[model samples]
Target: MTTTFDRGLALLGAILDAELGSAGYPGNAQLAARIGLDQATVSRMLKDLAALGLIERAERVPGWRVGPGYFALAAAAGDSRLLVRARPLLRGLVARWHEPAWLSVRSEGTALTVEAQLSHWSSYVAAAPGARTPIWCTGPGRALLLDHTEQQLAELLEGVEFIGGGPRAARGIPALAAYNSADRLAGVVVADREFEHDVVDFSAPVRDPSGAIVAALSLAVPRFRLADRTAGIAASVAEAAGALEVGAL
Candidate 1:
């Protein structure tokens, strides 16, 4: 009862998993060997995947890897769920704190905003959905790192350029490690004027039902408004994030 389409889809999935496991792009023969398919069949299926934008060939090298279309599909499916579930919660944060709130998830080593509730305040930092900020420089980014291992941290920081934004912006791995340690212990992170000198970001991790970190919920406000209320703001964000996890279940 196996249809040709089903078999083709299975092959595509196998090829994609193989490519994901490889360090670099794989050639058709390499993929065929990995997936136990003949070279000619693998080549034909690769062409089909390329046409569907599920896989792409390297421009400068004779190899293949997963393509942007795969990521787009993933984001649409997964991020949309998170956004929908977090919308009311983000709105609540804005309503309660009178500050902009954001929901972000890690994508390609950056914190990609998927949802935002802008503050009614005249002077506010506006962040549109799909805006990307470096993981090394944002509160949500550091909060996302709480689950990363030391080796993962090194890999993430490798070759990343550090730009100064505030007095507390971490300049090197040692400082970043220190920040991560403290944030992990506290279950939240506060970046005071880290991205913008006038902006203070408070963030807490959003975990899935299985206790894996899935995203971060954060609030951004003018530094002047955040004076002496860091703990309270962090607690609110953490409470909202916990509500999101419960809703997910």
Candidate 2:
């Protein structure tokens, strides 16, 4: 027999499934239909979940999404052991360079930041977890595409308008391709004043045991702050990424 607890868990699972499955965030009606529950019941349960921070109400849209509490639980329980290992690495990078470090994964056509480490400085580039940035310009975004073929890149970018980002951001396929060529040759992505006018980023892919790119690791520094240490920072970022792959896997 299904218990109340079971039903509650089922509702939560349904919400996550809908979001990850590309059905977008499910509203009360959708959740009600999905889990065979009354709309009122679903609403009450969602309120409870939101209170617990397991989920959050969507902004600018009608639906729900994962919240920081979920990430906290996952990290605490070793559900995402990779991220646990990444925390120290990110800290070390920040300590060494006094720049911000980020861990990201491709979410459709954008790069979704899953982890971030900020420096103590008053002035520094920072991105919080769950922030999404354009794939056509950001270092972490480009790093995630390092293994894709030209055709795969084209297909992924199809219907995506080349807009936003700094003035140097890629405005078309040709420009993106040109940037990709240099990145591919270097085996890491170097995005200079692309995602943000004053920030420069260096990123490398994080691979799973099977040698497939699962995510990207990046460090962002203000252009003025970077000075002459660009090459050193880039190489260190790449090395740290490799270490993450090995240690996590």
Candidate 3:
């Protein structure tokens, strides 16, 4: 099972491990050249490992250290979510927007909000921490599919209910555009259409140490506030998200 692809990856990982021991984990550009890879390839591999839970890191570092998830895969196991590390950052986002910020993870075609807090006076999502959202048509669901291929997106959305509203459960491609205006996963946004909620959302993709966007940070607000503070709150939230994204590394 260890193909050439894996070997190339192993070399890259070794380079990082070594650098961390010496240079304190330099940027990807330096690591790539040391490992005989170009910068972009190093970035791609880092994202791959981040998605697989082998490592996690922030964007500012330009490199990965390690993900808390690694402990789960080791012979001696610990928590799987790595939530403890994410809480402080997620909580700060709530304070930034004064609205409920949802913390979620995807599993078996469903997006589960594991943490919920309201920054505003009222609770919008109303979905508790354990709330499960179908991959069909929700902000978090669409956010997860932002960079995926058509088939990959479909595979993830199948059999899920489109409770959040849009075209339909099967036609979730719009969900991607609903988040990523640029049509790529570098960054994304979310707004409600055809639902009673009438909310607008903005989000940033959270990458693990390897540099892959695994989870996402999202904020929800009434459609009115969406336009009102589009520049102010949204920008601040994005900045904070950027901070968190980089901190994860």
Candidate 4:
């Protein structure tokens, strides 16, 4: 018993899932052919999708892909559960390190902050939820990269624009590989003024019971205090991540 409404929903779901798997946006003609719909119908549906925030045009190109609306809905559902378990731990990290603590998850090819607890200090890094950062330039980004395979990393790096915020920022795949290697060995990653010269970030992976990395827990501190506190900060972040994992289990 399939109604027109059900069929329409199915078409929309197919479009979203197909776009998710695509490395680049497929034009209306391509999508219409794939979905077995007429070009005009697909165009109309795409308009509706765009208006609903389920799809968006690429900023630098003439194509459509998953939009913030989809990510926002996914994040709201997933992050609410994650925050329920990670919030107290993030608060603990902020108290222990006297720095802002953040929880970020993979959003397409970028890192999206889902939760953050600001430090009490007057001068501190500001990371609001939904803030998106490059996957090659931040501690949590690098930490998240540790889960990617070489082929996946290569694919993700293709067409990526390197926006170096400082001398320490990773500008290419080689540098990102080095960072990932170090993070894998140490079980945590540190980015010192990579995204912003005045900020230092220490992050560790938050794993689910099945051992997949679900998010990254990070401590954001001022660069002036990073020299002597790097090790301590890393340890604190790691401990918080461990607690998150335990709570998830």
Work out the TM-score per prediction.
Answer: 0.68, 0.70, 0.56, 0.69
lDDT of 4 by residue, 96-158 (tens): 877788888777677777778877762344365656677788888888888776667778889
Expressed as tens digits, the lDDT of each residue in 127-150 for candidate 2 is 556566788889988899887777
What is the lDDT for 98 in model 1? 84
Candidate 3, residues 75-180: lDDT per residue as tens digits? 1113233455556666776777677676555655655555556565444562344445554456565566566776676576555444445442334455454445
Q: Which 10 residues in a row give candidate 1 its minimum summed lDDT? A: 122-131
lDDT computed for candidate 2: 0.80
What RMSD value applies to candidate 1?
10.8
lDDT of 3: 0.56
Q: Which ten residues in a row have the lowest lDDT in candidate 4?
A: 1-10
Runs in model 3 deviating more than 4 A are 1-82, 120-122, 159-186, 194-196
- Which scores higher on lDDT, 1 or 2? 2
TM-score of 4: 0.69
* lDDT for each residue of candidate 1 in 1-249, tens digit (9 for 90 to 100): 166455456665765776667546778777677667788987887887676456788778678777654674467456566778889999898888888898877777877666788777623452545556778778888888878776788888898767765667888777788888888878888887777777888889998889998888999878778778778889999999989888877
What's the distance in Å from true for residue 118, model 4?
A: 0.9
Residue 181, candidate 1: C-alpha displacement in angstroms: 0.7
